[model samples]
Target: MLKGILEGCVLKVIFDNETYGYEISQKLQEHGFQGISEGTIYPLLLRMEKNGLIEATYKASVLGPRRKYFTITGKGKGELEDFLTVYKEMERAVHHLFAQRKPEADSEENTGFGEPEWEG
Candidate 1:
């Protein structure tokens, strides 16, 4: 489940800018996705590459070895669009569910299902 979400996020990151795996992890962390390590991102990148969602090119790195930079393919762009559509729908449903539940929970507390209301 989370992997699917991460896949969409990684594709978006790549689509926005062609970058390497480590840099992708850093960007995600900067965007509030903490604890996303390169270890996790590498396999996802490999899978996206194999699935034809993204393509990689090797570029010389000033640091040391060549780095593999990723770019989104046509298919990847389409997938990202689909993912955003579904994600937005789910997000709305989740918000609606919680909004509806909050009133119910408050009413239950006032009704004294468990702890009694203070009233003092």
Candidate 2:
């Protein structure tokens, strides 16, 4: 469900910049995806690395232990592009479906659930 979408989102974030786990989670929250924990992010990062979509390097952190920073590989970039294409098609399809629905005014008129019409 959400995990599937989050994988693509994680890829996009890594594609945008090389970052560590906590920072990646923070970026997800900043982009309106709240409640995503570092625990979740780490597993996804590991999976991506295993899949060869991203590469990681150990870097010293000023605050604490060495951080494993992720950078998108060439394969990752290609996958991201594919995801973008699919996402855009889904977006357009959803928009078209919603557009075909009757407007609120029409709904109210037919359903008799809105304010009463007054005769002059």
| Pairs of residues at least 3 apart in sequence or in different chains that clash in candidate 1 | none
- Predictions in order: lDDT: 0.90, 0.86
Task: Give all TM-scores, in the order shown.
Answer: 0.85, 0.81
Candidate 1 Cα misplacement greater than 4 A, ranges: 102-104, 107-120
lDDT of 1 by residue, 1-120 (tens): 689899999999999999999999999999999899999899999999999999999999997999999999999999999999999998899777655644435666543243436853
Q: After superposition, how far is residue 32 of candidate 2 from its true place, in Å?
A: 0.4
Error of 2 at 13 (Å): 1.1
Report residue 106 deviation for candidate 2 (angstroms).
2.6
Model 2, 9-108: lDDT tens digits are 9999999999988989999999999799899888888889999999999999998999989999999999899888888888899778755645554665
Residue 2 accuracy (lDDT) in model 1: 85
